[model samples]
Target: MLPKFPMSRQCPYHPPAGYAALKKEGPLARVRLYDGRTAWAVTGYAETRQLLVDPRLSSDRSRPDFPVLVPRMAAAKLVALVGMDPPEHDVQRRMLIPSFTVKRVNSLRPAIRRIVVERIEALLDGGRREADLVPEFALPVPSTVICELLGVPYGDHEFFEEQTRRMLMATSTADEAAAAGGALNRYFDELIETKLAEPGEGLLDELIVDRLGPGELTRLELASIAMFLLVAGHETTANMIGLSVLTLLEHPEQLARLRADERVAAGAVEELLRFLSVADELQRVAAADIEIGGQVIRAGDAVYLPNAAANRAPEVFPEPDTLDVGRGTRHHLAFGYGIHQCIGQNLARAELEIALYELAVRLPGLRLAEPVEQLGTKPGGSVQGILRLPVVW
Candidate 1:
């Protein structure tokens, strides 16, 4: 029998352990998905980069052929930005490019640094030697930063965060996921109405002011974008911060290097992204019959790109399984490749660099409270992360 796709990682420190055999199968090999559908697993780093840019592959989730890696994505409506294809995708992305530019992200560094500092202080409050980093530190830093950037109130983070967890958690049934998603949509819908009445200086507010009048965007799209940004903005980065901290603790020499020299902080973040690859899956479907790696993916076939595997390809990264903080090569597909690459990558990098570096410096004695094996992974979801990262300084 073919190995199942999305095989779970037995340990949080690496990709799903089964990817080694799968990669050996070929660059584009077939794997069985949950629904018993066979999709082409793009396991080669170079092939993944080539096909991601190919126009024949579609990111559109609306298609019946789109792989439902998890039940939540099955029959779901297309998300505003990530689920689109150009020129609509291009149009939507164009609206936000200026906001995520290097200059703009750089301007937010002071504020991001301040946010990381506050989170560290919170973790250290009451002279507490131990706290769950997931809630106390990792989750809040990016949550606050993204909340401030998107103009969404950080006070309501609990509601939205729970809703997002429900939507993404693998255990959630389709109905439960649908309901959680609906709750978020309704929440954002109301928030949009509120913005209409009392404008705030958020990205959503700017969209409402600038685009709604020109027929350039709709209130619904605004809500979807808000939901997407809020969820994507925090959950992924939060997990990254938690996992990156755990990783650094596991590799003291690398951690010490980062703390000793601030210059390595930026590259360290990149290495962490490549090494951890917390976002384990990036799925696409063939729009037409396409060929790569001596294989043909039929039209309407799903192509699963486990960047987790691709990032670990030995040919791409020497000793692919080993973690190297100084291996800051930007060649990995962690943020993805092609026109659909992550728009918020710069912000994520800034957030990770600030969060990781600050923790290393402030909590020099930081160590994991629980045995690595005793820790729980994020319940089934496309995103790979530790459920609760317990730590003490």
Candidate 2:
């Protein structure tokens, strides 16, 4: 019997129960997708890493054969770097690399620290004994930071946030997703034109005055990149912040360890990332016939690399089920691997470290207001994360 693709997880902190059987079957196995299409699902640590970096694989979503995990994803266009293959991918990535360098990300540290403090203060000022951390703190820090970075007006965040939420939700219909995408594209079109006329002090302005003026990039291309940054920049890290707090609270010992010694905060972030590989699957299509681990992925075949399973592979992480804040998790695929790895990873790491550290210091008595199983999770999507994390201190 063929396994089903995009299996649902029994718990947010772990992969779907079916993943164990799939891993036991082998590194690569055939699975049926939601659309009744058969594709290869790579479930092993080594195979996932190998194929992610393999030139024979393609990230172009424009390909007719590319795997569609959800109905909405099928309507997606290949305008952003995540969907573009190299040469074009290389050129586009290089243009934004300077903004995310270690030094550049570090320069933003003061601002990120300030955001965290202000959010925490607001939560305290409310004087509420119990609150949902998602909207109260987790979502705001990253949203504000991305708004500042992109020169997007924070007052307009509600519009883009609603559109992006609709676009990412698995329950959203193809038409709904397309409508959301269209709204974002049109919004950016107007914003890009404004930036061109009166360049501001944000990244969009830099790209306009430097890259666009030089004719190195088209207005549409610049707009697409801005849209990509706006969505990808906040969504992933915001989810991480909420989930990380919940995970640490669940394991009081680990939380206490972090609170006691702030020095281990960095290591704690890596462990949290490995433990909760939020992106359940990475989609790719074979550009050419490729053979690995006694399986042949023919040219034009769809491939699904489930990093959640790979991160838990026992061969790489002994007793992978347990959460250890001091564990060496540098090799985890949480940020992906190879050329398509997350471009904003440095910025993400900084935000997480500061946010988690502040939470530990300010809310020493923090605990879950509801049972772990009762917490709300975003349903039927590639990104696995909590919709609301209620807590009290």
Candidate 3:
């Protein structure tokens, strides 16, 4: 049984400083998880890429030795997205991929642009010269987009937003995250029933009634997909928007360069991803005994491949710590490499490009409302997000 401790400390990847330590330790080191098991943490760029690409590394957490972020129950639900080994993961991912394709997501650009404009207008109208970019701008963009994509009614997102926030907040205890997960599952169960009754063009509608036909996904599977989109699609982009916004505001010179040339925004987004790297590590268990970096990972051993660390590795990126947006270093693995590379990469790119470009262009004279360290933050999750990035224009 796992020891009872705060979930905040149990997170295998927390402070970026850990990566510096791992660099000195030759790429891999042991760390404890919420389940109280010590597992190998991979930080080197080459090793991280190998671990993610290796067929021998299983994303399944069902193994007894799997060192998970939350408790067994919560981790099980969280891993539903590309978390399982081949066959099953492939099937589920295939069903979900088309909805997030560049073509489909691009169709929603009008809606996304409308959403961004409305939110910015509201923020401006509120008359607060300084506001938290997170709750006001960063959180709403992705939340609205994901809800719109999944066919979730805008009115119904209150519960989902709350539950997803709890689950994504790394500081939440295992029980807390699990409870949030359960609530989200229940919400999806009801939402799926609604989608079943009224088939629409969105992903949920097609998955249940149209694409899958009858009995393709049981009630549980339907609910699982709904919850998966809620968390997976919403939280990560929200954090990135906030981090990217803060990053640009902090470095005005780069922001000016990006504003001067729209062509540079794409490269800037990639560099920001490599620098901030909010998506952290992807965890897996060894399917069979495999050797990585001369260290043997026995079957059933848990592994964490920290993409954030690897993206900043000195070996792959020259001057890894500095944010050189125009370096044109697009080869970074901020998104996990190999088959499980994020299906929503294009959508994420579009959102980041739109958000960053619009802010730089419209919110002229934008500056930090407070000192960098003074910004409020919640810790312990896969993404390190600012709670309140106060800013002034």
lDDT top scorer = 2
Tell me the TM-score of each prediction against the true structure. 0.98, 0.98, 0.91
Model 1 stretches with alpha carbons more than 4 Å out: 379-381
Alpha carbon lDDT of residue 346, candidate 1?
97
lDDT of 3: 0.75
Which residue runs does candidate 2 get wrong by more than 4 Å?
A: none
User: On a 0 to 1 TM-score scale, where does candidate 1 land against the true structure?
Assistant: 0.98
Each prediction's number of clashing residue pairs: 1, 0, 2
The stretch of ten residues in a row with the least summed lDDT in candidate 2 is 375-384
**lDDT ranking from best candidate downward:** 2, 1, 3
lDDT of model 2 at position 63? 80
Write the residue-wise lDDT of candidate 1 on 210-319 in tens digits.
88768898878878888888888988999999889888899999999999999999989988999988877788888899878989999989888888889988887999
Instruction: Compute the lDDT of residue 258 as modeled in candidate 3.
Output: 87
Stretches of model 3 off by over 4 angstroms after superposition: 1-15, 34-36, 70-78, 126-128
Per-residue C-alpha lDDT of model 3 across residues 141-257, encoded as one tens digit per residue: 988888788878878667888887677666566777778888988888877777667777667777777544666667887787778777878788888899888888777899999
Worst 10 residues of 1 by lDDT: 373-382
Instruction: Give the alpha-carbon lDDT of every model.
Output: 0.87, 0.88, 0.75
Error of 2 at 27 (Å): 0.6
